[model samples]
Target: MDVDFTFRKPIDVSVILSTLLDAGMRSSTEGREVAYLVDEDGMFEWRTAAEYQLNEVMRELGDPRWNDRVVGMTLFFAEAETGGDFLFHPGRESMSCVVGINPKLFQGSSRFCDIGWYLANLVPLLEPLGLSEIEARDSP
Candidate 1:
């Protein structure tokens, strides 16, 4: 579940990341998700790099227990375990909309959250990052 929000001002997702981490919202994050184009199909066909940056081998191997797939992109400011897997748009600037990935599987896990939640909760948290520009809260 991705919650899209229209921001009144330019926003750099990386800055949001740093701010959240600094606030202990996320335990840690070293860098952005390492993306690898997995295919050219109708799908987005990309996967974040594994621990060894081995997106190819890991995808090929397809072993679940390996913990090698960078589970929800281990390096991201993703709280997959807490239903706050906020997606990062690397290098994006001046975007009118940003989707906040939210899963409704309960806070102890990944996926759906919203503008109601995104704005009310995230806006304040992001103020220190010099942004609180979300214009309105609505479901897409």
Candidate 2:
């Protein structure tokens, strides 16, 4: 499912990284491993808190397609075991995050564009992660 949620404000980069790490740990405890996406290459290095400088990675992965609106934004985080990715956008007004499922995993009539099922599975997982302020919406 395609879901979008924004932070209440422009939160600190450290906080964002910490939150993502915490989520990954929690998922691991539940048998679902999550990791930060390093690059499009096969290099899937698991990073430690001390190893990452969010701003640096953001700069390296900046997407110009956003027209400078989301400078330093990066779509470089994903589940290590599963096949989904997270895109983080630190906009001037707020910060947004997206979680998407890999389409290649589905096929034939089973391939559906609607993200209702994905949202249903994700909302509860994120609720306890101190993201209550996030306003989430399902995109078409």
Candidate 3:
């Protein structure tokens, strides 16, 4: 179920950024399913036509809820822009390609408490992608 495997290498960050950007662009235009990868370090990076940085992604595999349940790791998604800045966003349907775990986990919770738990963990984990901090709309 792993979408793709991203080993830590010199191009690891750029590779991830490019894939996601390409996928996002395709989704924005031609409508295609996106593919991404994460390493054990929680480096959630992707790519498309350009490189991006996802140093801030969280690691859900280590969570108590998933200690034995989920394998692999968590990663953040990001994109680079023309201005040399990066933009991070909550992973949308497009950025996420699921594997190993139940896809249902991604669906929003009906219970307010469950939703709160989901976002609380998700926010800090995803903060490193720095989506909220960067306005990478210019596109890389």
**Per-residue alpha-carbon lDDT of model 3 for 1-110, expressed as tens digits?**
11222222212233334344444322211232222333324454442221222222222222233222212223232231111112222222112223222222323643
Q: Which stretches of candidate 1 lie over 4 Å from their true place?
A: 27-43, 49-80, 88-118, 128-140
Model 2, position 1: C-alpha lDDT score? 36
- TM-score per model over all chains: 0.39, 0.39, 0.21
The whole-model lDDT of each prediction reads 0.39, 0.40, 0.27
Instruction: Write down the TM-score for model 3.
Output: 0.21
Candidate 1, after superposition: displacement of residue 35 in Å?
8.7
Judge candidate 2 against the unseen true structure and give its global Cα lDDT, from 0 to 1. Answer: 0.40
Best by lDDT: 2
**Pick by lDDT: 2 or 3, better one:** 2
Clashes of each: 7, 0, 16
Candidate 3 or 1, higher lDDT: 1
lDDT for model 1: 0.39
Model 2: residues >4 Å from true position, as ranges? Answer: 25-80, 83-85, 90-109, 113-140
